[model samples]
Target: MPLALYLLALAVFAMGTSEFMLAGLVPDIASDLDVSVGTAGALTSAYAIGMIVGAPLVAAFARNWPTRTSLLSFILAFAAAHAVGALTPDFPVLFATRVVAALANAGFLAVTLTTAATLVSPDRKGRALAVLLSGTTTATVAGVPGGAVFGTLFGWRATFWTVAALCLPAALGVLKGISAGLVQEHAADGPASHTELATDGPALRTELAQLARPRLILVMLLGALVNAATFAGFTFLAPVVTDAAGLGELWVPVALVLFGVGAFTGVTVAGRLSDRHPGPVIAVAGPLLLIGWPALALLAAEPVALLTLVFVQGALSFALGSTLITRVLYEAAGAPTMAGSYATTALNMGAAVGPLLAATTLGTAAGTLGPLWSSGLLIAAALLIALPLRTTISTGRGIEVPR
Candidate 1:
C-alpha cells in the first residue's frame, strides 16, 4: 500500500518482462545467431539455473548490507546486463548476459519481498507480498505479448533494447523511492533506524539454522511441488491445446490470454484471503487443480470446455503459489530475504523439472494428456506435504514451530 511497494512492483515488472520475453524470441534468436531452436531455447534454462544458484549466494553476500542498498545494486546490475544483451553479437555473449541478468533479478526479488514485508504490519504481509508479485502476473498478461509483437515488427534485438530501456526507469524509481522511505522511517524512529532491517553475524547463523529445520524443509518442498504441478501442464500448453484439445494453432494465444487474466484475478483474490486465512486458501486451490487437470485431459476435444478449464486452472495454480510464498515468509520470520531467496530457488528448480517431466510424458504413449495427469499427481503430493502446516496452525503452534 506504500508508494515504495508499487515502485518495487515496477522493478519486478521490468525483470519479469525480460525473463518471459525470451520465450517469444527463441525462433528469431536461433536464426539470427546461426544456432538450432533448441540451442537458443537453452537461454531460458540458463536463466532459471542462474536464479537457482545465484539467489542463496547473493542473499548470503548481501547479508550485512542495508535493504535499500542491496536492492539498488541488484537493479542496476540487472539493467546493465540487459544493455549488454541488447548489443551482443553472438549466442555465447547473449547466454552469459542471461545468467548475469538472472542473478541480479534473483537478488532484486529476494530483497524486494523482504523490504515489502517490513513496510507493512505483520498481519498485512501476505497482501503486501501479493502486491509485489502482481508485477509478474501483469507481465504475463501484457509484457510478453507486447514484446512478441515488437520483436515480430522490428527485430529480436529491438525487444531487448526495449526491455533495457524499461529497466532504467525502474532502477531510478527504486533508488528514489527506497531512499525516501528509509529517510522518513529514520526521522520517525531516531536512533532505532535499523529496526526493520536485517542484521549480520549471530543473527544470520540463527536464521540459517531455522531455515534448515525439517518443517521448513517440508514447506520448501511443498512450494517446489506446487510449482511443478502448474508448469508441468503449462510449459506444453500449446501442444496440449492443439493436439490434445483439438484446437487450431490460432487458438493458442487466446488460451494464453485467458490464462493470464485468470492468473491476475487469482493473485488479487489471494492477496485479500491469504492475510486472513492462508491455510484454507491453499487447501482449496490445490484441490481445484487436482480436479481441474483430469477434467481438462478428459474434455480436451471440447473447445468450450477446454477454454473454461484453462482459465480456472490458471487461477487455481497461481492462487496456490501466492499462498505458498506467504507461508514461507511467515515460517521463516527472522530471515525474510533468505527465506524468499530459498523460495525462489525452489520455484526455479520446479520450473526446470516440470518441463522435463512433461516432455518425457509427451514422448510416452500417454502423449499430451500425460502432463495434465502428472500435474494433478504432483499437486496431490504437495497437498499431503502441506498437511503439517494446517495442523500447526490449528494447534495454535504456528508461531512456535518456526522458531
Candidate 2:
C-alpha cells in the first residue's frame, strides 16, 4: 500500500469521528443550548442533508480544480465549520455551522474516493477504496467512543474543539503528501469527459443508469429501508431501554458503544470478505438481518439479553452495507466518483427517511417496542431484496487498459 493511502485513511477517520460523535453528544448540546432533543436531533439530520446535497454539487462544480487544492480547501472549510460549532453560543448559529461542516464532510469523502481510484491499479481499486473506507469503520470503533468519553469528561463543545485540533494534523498530512496528479482526473472533462468513455462509456453509463433499473432500483430502495430499519429502533434506544428493558440512563452510551463495536467489526469483515467471496458475504448479511430483528426484540423483552443479541444484530445487519457500495463501484467503472456519490446519497436519503419513520412510529406506540418492531420488519424486508441480487449480480475482474 502507498503511504498516501494511510494519510487518506487518517483524514477519513477524523471526518467520521467528527460526524458521528454528535450522536453521543446530542444530549450535552441540547442541554447546553436549552433545546429539546428533537431539535438537537436536527443537527444530525442537517449534516445528512448537507452530505446529500454537497456530494454531487461539489463533484460537478469542483471537477476542474486540482485534487490537492480541492482537498485542502475542504479540510480547511471543515476545520472552520467545526471551530464555529465549538464556539457558537446559540442554537441557530450552531445549526448553521453543522450544515457547513457537513458540506465539507461530503466533499471530502467524494474526493477521497475519486482520488483512491486514481491512486491504484484498476484491479486493485476495490482494495484501495476499502483502505480509505477503513477510516469510517475505524471511527465507529475508536473515534466515536473516544469522543463520547471526551464529551462525558469535558462537555459537548469540548468534543468539537478536540475534532478541530485533530483536523489540523489531518490537514497537514494531506497538504504535505498528496500528489497533484492524484486529484487532477476527477475534473478531467468536468461535464465533457463523457466522450472519453465512449464505447466503454455506454457500459459505464448503463451501470450508473442502473440507478433507474428495477433490480438496481430495488437495491437503492432498500438502502433507505435498511437504514430506516436500524434507525427507527436505534433513534429511540434510550427511551426503549429505560422504559421497556428497565435499564438506566448509563446503558444508553453503553448500547451505542456496543453498536459501534458491532459496526466496526462488520465493516472490516465485509471489506475483506467482499474481496475474497463477495457473493457469500452479501448472502450471509441477508439472513443476518432476519436474525437481528428477533435478537433486538428478544433483547428488548429481556434487557439482560442485551450484550449477545444487540451486538449480533448490530454487526450482522451492517456487515454487507459498505460492500454493497463496492459492488456499485464495480459496476460504475469509468465514473466511480459519481457512482460513489450516488450510492452515498441514496444511503443518506435512507438515513433521513429512517428517522422520520421512527418519529412517526414511536409517537403512536405505547412503548419503545413500536419503533423496534417497525425497524425489525423493515430489515426483514431488506433481506428479501438483497437475497435475489446475490444470485444474479456478476462482477468481472479486469486489467488496467490505456485510458
Candidate 3:
C-alpha cells in the first residue's frame, strides 16, 4: 500500500478509540457533569447513531466537493469537535460535539476507504482494507485501554485533547499525500467509475440509488451480522472476564489485549489472501466462531479455556469481518464514490444493533454470558446468510473483488 493509507489508518486509530473509550470514563463523566451514569453512557450511543446516519448524508453532501477539500474539512471538523468536547462544560454541548465528531469521522472514513481503493491496483484492495482495519484493531488493544489508563492518571478531558492533537498531523499528512488528480476525479491511468458518479456532482438520490443492488444489500447484511457478533460479545468483555470468570480487575485489560492482538493477526492474514480466497476464509472462520462462542458460554469459569477462547474468537471474528467488509466494497463496485459509505453503514449498524441485543440479554438468566450466547446466535445467522453464497462461490478464486 501507500504512505497515504498508513496516514489514514493512523487517524482511524484515534477515532476508533473514542468510539468505546467513553465506556471506561462514563463514571467520571457522570460525576463531573453531575448526571446519572445512564445519561452519561448515552454519549457513546450518540456517536454510534451519528456514524450510522451521517455516513450516507455526508458522503452525498461531499460528493460534489473536491475529494481533498472534503477530506481535509472532515478531518479538521473531527479534531475541532474533540477539542471542543475536551473544553466544554455543559453536558449538552459535549453531546453535540460527540455527534459532530462522529459525523466527521463517518465522512472522512468513507472517503478514506474509497480513496484507498482508488490508490491501489485491483488485486491489492483487500490488503489496503486490511491495513485500514488493522488501525481499528490496534485501537482495541492499545488506544482504548491506554486511553482508559491515561484518563485515570490525568482526566477524561486529557484523553479527548490527545485525540484532538493527533488529528492535526493526520490532516496535514492526508493533505500532502493525496493525489491532486484523485481529488479532481481525473486519475492519470483510467476511468474513475468506481470513485465517482458518471456525471459531475451527482444528486443525493443518485448516490442513494446505488445501494439498490440485490447483491450489494446481501453483502452489506452479511457485514452487519458479522459485526453484530463481534460487538455484542465485546461490549461486555470486561464484565465477562471479571464478573463471570471471577478474574481480578487486572485481567480485564489482559483479555482485551489478547482479543485485540488476535484481531491484528486476523486482519493481517485476511489482507494477504481475501482478494483471492475470501470464500475459504469465511467458510473456515464462520464455523469455528459458531462453535467457539457457545464453548465460551459453557466454559467462562475456567480461566485457561476462557483466555484461550477469547484470543481464538477474536482472530476468527476479525478475519471474517475483514473479508465481509472487503466484500461490501467489491459488491458495491457500481456505487461510484458511495461504496465506502455503504461499508460504513453496514459496519456501524452492527455496532448499534449488537449492543442493544446484548443489553437486553443482561437482565435475563444468562447474565454476563448472555452476550456470548447472543454472539453465537449471530454467528449462526451469519453462516446462514452465507449459505447461498457457497454455491455461487464454490472456489474462492472466482469472485471479482477489490484491487
Candidate 4:
C-alpha cells in the first residue's frame, strides 16, 4: 500500500532473484567451473547453510542498530557479493561470495519482517508482514524465471550481472522510500538485558531455560519441521514435473508459474484466515500437505493429477507459512527481532534438512515415489510435532496480535 512497502518489495524481488537463480544456473556453473553437477548443487546447500548461520549471527550482533542502517548495509553487501560472484574465477571464492550474498539476504529478510511488522497497528501486523513477504513469492514467479532465461540467452555470468545491476537500483529505491518512523518503531523495542538474553540466547545455559516451557519449543520445532517438509518436495518440484509427471520439458516453467500463482494467492488468504482464527489455520496446513502429496505422487503416471496437486500444495504451504511466522513472533513476543531472526533460521534449517532428506531418498530409491513417500511421512511427523501447540495459545488476542 505504502510506497515504502513497494520499495521493500522491490528489494525482496532482487534478493529473491539473486538467491534462487542458482538452481537454474547450476549446470552452467558446473560446466564453466569444471565441476560435477553434484558439486555445483552444493551452491544451493551452501546458501542455505549461510542463511541459517547468518540470521542469528546478524541479529545478535546488529540488534542494537537502526533498521535502515542495518537493512541498507546488508543490501549493499548483497549487491557487492553478487557483483563479485559475477567475476570470481576460483570456485571456492565464487562459493564464498554466494554465501556472503546469502548472509546479506538472510539478514535483510529477518530485519524486513521486523520492520514491516512494526509499520502498522497491531491489527494489521499480519497483513503488513504478508505484503513484505509477497515480494519473495513474486520472485519465484518473475525473477528466477527471468534469470533462467537470461542465463540461457547470454550466460550464467550475465544472469549474475543482471541481478547485481538490479540490486543497485533496488538499494537506491529502498533508501529513498524507507521511512524514519518505521525505523524508529523497530528500534523502540531494544533487545532484552544480558540476563534475559542469556536465558534466551542459544547457549548451553539458555537451552534449558528456554525449553523449560514445552509449548514455546513445540511451536518452534514444529514450525521448523513443517518448513522442512514443505521444502523437501519443493526443492525439486520442477524436475519432478518434467521427469516424473511425464510433462514435456516446456511445461516446467509454466508449472512453476502456476505454483507461484498458487503461493501468492495462498499467502494473502492465509494471512486473513490467521487473522480470523490462527489456531485452526495452523492446524489445517499439514493435513493439506498430506492430502496433496498423494495426488502429487500419482504424477509418476497421472500427469494431470500431479499438475493439480502442485498448485494445491503451493497454496497450502504459503498460506500456512504466514501463520507460522506470526505464531513464532507471538510466541517470542519478548524478543521480536530475535524471534524474527530465529523464525528465518528455522526456515533456513528446514531448507537445508528437507532437500538433504529428499536428495537422499531420491538417490537411494528405485523411482520418484521415494521422495513423494518421504515427503508425506515427513509432513505427518511435522504435524504430530504441531499437535501440542493448540494448548499453548491463549484466545485473549482475538486476532489482535499485540506488538
Q: Rank the candidate models, highest lDDT first.
A: 3, 1, 4, 2
In model 3, what lDDT does residue 243 have? 88
Candidate 2, residue 205: CA error in Å? 9.9
Give the residue spans of candidate 4 off by over 4 A.
179-213, 364-366, 393-403
Tens digits of per-residue lDDT for model 1, 102-155: 999888877777677667665666788888878887887788888888999999
Tell me the tens digit of each residue's lDDT in model 4 across 1-403. 4566767777888887777788899999999999999898888878888899998788767666666777888889988988898898778988999899889988988787766665555555567767876887898888888889999999999988887777776677667766432442322334211111222324323422543555556666766776677777777777787777777888888777777777788888876766447777766776888877766876556777777777888788777766776666666555655666766876778778887788777766535556666678777887776666455642324232223
Q: How high a TM-score does candidate 4 get? A: 0.88
Clashing pairs in 2: 63-187, 197-201, 224-350
TM-score order, best first, reads 3, 1, 4, 2
Candidate 1 segments whose C-alpha is farther than 4 A from its true place: 180-202, 393-403
> lDDT for each of the candidates?
0.78, 0.69, 0.85, 0.72
lDDT of 1: 0.78
How many residue pairs clash per model? Answer: 0, 3, 4, 0
Q: Where does model 3 exceed 4 Å of error?
A: 181-206, 392-403
**Best-fitting candidate, measured by TM-score?**
3
For each candidate, give its TM-score against the true structure.
0.92, 0.84, 0.93, 0.88
Better-scoring candidate (lDDT), 2 or 3:
3
**Clashing residue pairs found in predicted model 1:** none
